[model samples]
Target: MEVREIALGAGESYELRLTGRGARGYVWTWQVTGNADAVSVSEAAPPPAQTLPGAPLERAYVVRGRSPGGRARIRFAQIRPPYPQEAPYDEFVLEVEVTAATGGP
Candidate 1:
């Protein structure tokens, strides 16, 4: 996975979509590394249960900018049950910057 950078206005929100192979039993999960209050994250829906093998599943997350002049580092990981003893299956980070909202002319 690769890190992504995005910007949003104060009080605004954005939806992020991530993909994983459901047939492999790997699912995407996320958490806010910093500024949890300034930026909130929640899952839009649960991952689909695959009816066929090698099916792709998409998970969506909603991130909101609560205040201006703040940043939030969100980390997402792909893992299976029983926990891995070594490195995680996959991981990525999303860096978000929240700026002041612009006024319409």
Candidate 2:
């Protein structure tokens, strides 16, 4: 598993991209934990279709800061369905800290 830390202002957002073997039925799934209310996660547009077999696939997600003075953890796993008991081929985690947005003149 890999972990990353990030900081954002309230209402700010970032784009996350993950690669997987979609042609082989592998997909990336994600969940939010720890102060979940502090952030919002949503799937972005799908990647362009791949013509080659067993080609790598990319998926994008948008993570937005929703509340100030809050922290959230986002976990992503790449696995195939019907094998929930099996370990994921890859995993990634994100630790996010959100701060209040600064005022502008």
lDDT scores for all predictions? 0.80, 0.90
**lDDT of model 1, residue 52:** 60
Q: How many pairs of residues collide in model 1?
A: 0
* TM of each candidate vs. truth: 0.81, 0.93
Q: List the residue pairs that clash in candidate 1.
A: none
In candidate 2, what are the lDDT values of residues 4-104, reduced to their tens digit?
Answer: 99998998998988888888888898899999999999989887765577778888989999999999999999999978888999999999999997677
For candidate 1, give the lDDT of residue 89.
Answer: 76
For lDDT, the strongest prediction is: 2
Residue 67 miss distance in model 1 (angstroms)? 1.7
Cα RMSD (angstroms) for every candidate in the order listed: 2.2, 1.2
- Candidate 1 lDDT, 1-105, residue by residue in tens: 789999989878899888776678777777786676668888897865544667677779888887788888999888875566545577879999989987879
